[model samples]
Target chain A: MQSTITGKAYVLGDNIDTDQIIPAQYLTFNPAVPEEYQMFGKFALSSVPASQAGLPKGHVPFHTKDEFVSDYRIIVGGKNFGCGSSREHAPIALDAAGIEAVVAEFYARIFFRNAVNGGYLVPFESVNRLCDRICTGDDVKIDVENNLLHNLTTGEQWQLKPLGEVAPIIDAGGVFPYAKKVGMLKV
Target chain B: MPAMTMTEKILGRHAGRDSVQPGDNIWVDADILMTHDVCGPGTIGVFHQHFGKNAKVWDREKVVIIPDHYIFTADAMANRNVDTLRKFVAEQNIKYFYDVGTPRYKGVCHIALPEEGHTRPGEVLFGTDSHTCTAGAFGEFATGIGNTDAGFVMGTGKLWVKVPPTMRFVFHGNLPPYLMAKDLILAVIGDIGCDGATYKAMEFDGDGVYALNIEERMTLCNMVIEAGGKNGVIAPDQVTLDYVNARNASGKKYDVVTTDQGATFCYERVYDVTKLEPVIAKPHSPDNRAYVSEVRGTKLDRAYIGSCTGGKMTDFRAAAGILKGRSVKIDTFVVPATSEIAAGLKSEKLNGQSLEDVFLSAGAKIGQPSCAACLGGPSDTFGRLNGPISCISTTNRNFPGRMGHKEAKVFLASPLTVAASALTGVIADPRDCLQ
Candidate 1:
């Protein structure tokens, strides 16, 4: 795992559930097949409206895109991010779409575990006001070891909760590799 | 030593420790593990890849495999997922593999888990499906996990877990006849919002909770995940013990655990069930709840009753009690949760007519036991939202495009509320329709 990650932020609001991240319809493909697994990246956030014409009168925070943009590597989200189903595909899709880290005020417990165990992305929890300070396409630097995130665009800094026991698992590249390193796997 | 909650006690036992506190990270042995067709194939693949192709499972008998979702779909890819589960179950020599089209096959994994006796008090259970928390009604510490974590549990029978802080919910007074456990839970989720209980164990108990039957308790625990809770637990009582004793096939003695009187909780809430009204979660989110009266007369194109959360016999009975001799004004689909539930609908009767007969005579389409139209099946699925149709569903979620079409709107209610809405062609309060 990188001690510090620098990337552009893709901001999302509260309660961005697994369904919004990747719907159940897109989960029919067999994960054993690499070709099918590769399709998850394209389907990430496919539910977000591509244009505001049909959108009902409400606060719509996501970008208008049918496909995930590879440019944004950090997701800055409000409270309870990844709040629905226990589909690891949400994080898998995000990882495949080149999201290196997620900074949220809070995360659904299962998504947090999935992110850590999958070792595909880093889940950094910041203060509730962190999302208010950051915006889309802003350059952000996450110093994981120091428990801090710096927004270069606004010159604002946010404190991050240290990853404690979860840090080594993420560093070992997911649970399977960590298990192997700690001699949990016999083979 | 500090007093322990039920979740702490269960996890401590599984972790082989004298006691455990909130935020303690420990590796615990799972008492029962589950996987369904949707996530089973991926989990099986991961298990094989990491544990070596020829390695056997840690304990084939301890793992439960059920092909529930995507079983009845015409889509070849969906069918292939079940075929993969069938092949893996046969090869692994699993004892509790429920394959579709078999006499022993049950419908939804969550319902089947308890019905088949995989859940017990004072045990630690995990499943790939998020609603796996439903088994917490049996006084167990149960939660959902991803495919990879499930795969690890399959191979090793153990996984690492962090103890979560406990939140206590106490319900007092008598529950009104018109409202069901679904309404009570919806109110809880609404009060807490979606993220209020994140990473916390929600312990539901009180005089009102003790009054509910096992099935209704299941409904309450099933939606704890909707509020970002790690698990929902109710202490096992005579009602739970009776249900378990009647269903369990292994004859294993259960260690029932309860929270100490002085147990610490991060949060505490109280509700008077008598004062609660029938509630519905409006479109786009389960926590977007409103009173049934608030949305009354809102037009709906269809009404659906089925899913692991709401498709049990008790739910159907409540719906039948309201829909007797009345024909639906809109498209209505009635689905039983399992084959046993389907049989119960056929055998049980109201006014000398079987519940199934009443539904069929009332212009309701009775579908198979699989999770039909709940998770948004293939295009050919019955009762699937095709266009901009508005629906009142008994399913757990009403997320955008969750049932079928992205443009379709969904309102979630109890079986009685759904039946009432079906008769009026709009969202109607069950209390208004009841005699």
Candidate 2:
């Protein structure tokens, strides 16, 4: 599902792992449902006690189809985004969240490839501007193809490079479809 | 002219047109190709899509498929990937399909390959897993490739490789007890920055490499990637072939070779470890190595001794020997890299009993053959911890709190060291309990 409208941004904090991407407990029950906000709430607000913090109150304990609701497409994370496990589902879940691209400073080799092959775009940028300036809910308009990430709320722009050497493949709809079009594989 | 290395020579031989030099993009044929469950599923789809018909893999015999991350802790999506690979392997008639627990299958990826006699000297080996460089211990130029690249290799039997300049690391002097190839490599990683060898090939030189057993060499080459090297190779000698012959009874008439007498190197670092203590890599970064004694009293919630890096047969013996009469601290998990390693230990009737028993007595859960807990590539959690937690692991990497929580810490060490630490429940030099 392509984004409803272009010119959007998604945001995330640092140290995003495959486990928090889709907690292991939900793996058995649901095969293909997005849960973007389901686990992040716990991880982001972990240290901030529920009674004394500025985080939203808890809802259902388990992942639901609603957490996939989108308002963001660009993610600004710290070093080693998508670490832990070679689970392609981590990117698949993000694609299900309608993420046009990720704007992490760096990524694990496997996760970077999985995202491109899954047809989800991830344009990495130097986190210099967005590192401390951008908040969790800040709106970022990242034109990954143009090497730029612009925060709409704060009017800050970050220059970045789209997926290295593999973005064209994602535009063709994952590796299989890309290879099929290139006559590398039989359709 | 930039001097040539063994890897370039081998890749040149495979390239078959002209000599390939460092920094030159050379297309060479792969002698052996492997993909685990994580990368296998994607390659399967690409193989069919790229071939324009039923997927006709370049070579069925040389290719192997193993489900590394999806055994006991099955992720539905990963299992789907496994199913995709299984069905494709059958359709393509791919011969070496190693389901977990199968006979002749055991330990981490590199451990299983050599045990099966798949890796050989002078070969251009490739795997879909990063630590595939472990095969270089057999004196081959082996490296890891991504899924898409593997897909291309699976369909076409060839991939582009940049022939890298060779960096010779000369080790001299006798290795102290409890100081192993793992410690040696960690120290090297410290000396040379993690990216010091990026896109370059590493060859262990001097008397030290020859003195160390082949299993120990695997440990050295296995984590070469963590140092950003594409491959790690050691010239094959009699000892190398001896380890090969010992594995599978495949007296395949090995042609052992060495680097030309005065092969040029891009860089050479030396270490005498004659008096080096047990080494441990601190948390968040594998390159941050320190003496084990320096990191004493670092408590741990887990201890893993499996994975391609430290899952060799001798590694088990080293750990089991050090752990003979001692019991493991509670909450340690011991997973053999492959089932054959378990079988080998079991058949040896270690300590006049089962290898599993020794590990169990040492407070380890005999985990099934798979890369587990090491990377959380499978097992999801590092378990609820008391305060800040630490883990002494024999597997690769101690990436920022890699085990579980960010507050948690991981220490990278050898199988012997990890087992001893698991017994003590804190970071202690294995030599402490040795004599």
Q: Cα deviation of B403 in candidate 2 (Å)?
A: 4.6
Deviating ranges (above 4 Å) for candidate 2: A1-66, A77-96, A103-119, A122-187, B21-23, B49-53, B73-86, B100-107, B162-168, B191-200, B245-268, B347-365, B377-389, B400-408
Superposition error at A93 for model 2 (Å): 5.0
lDDT of 1 by residue, B1-435 (tens): 679999999998899997899999888999888998888988898899888888788898889998887777778888888889888888989999888888989989999998998889998889998999999999999999998899899999999999999999999977888999999999999999888788999999899999999999999999999998999999999999999988885876789999998999999999999998999999888999999999898999999999988899999999998899999999999989899999999999898999999999999999999888887867777678878789999999877778877778999899989999999998999988885
Interface RMSD (Cα, Å) for model 1 = 1.3
Tens-digit lDDT track of model 2 for A62-103: 212455434555555655566544445566556565556666
For each model, chain A TM-score?
Answer: 0.87, 0.71
Candidate 1 stretches greater than 4 Å from native: A49-69
If you assessed candidate 1 against the hidden native complex, which CAPRI class would it receive? medium
Span of ten consecutive residues with least summed lDDT in model 2 chain A: A54-63
**Lowest summed lDDT over 10 consecutive residues: which window, candidate 2 chain B?**
B378-387
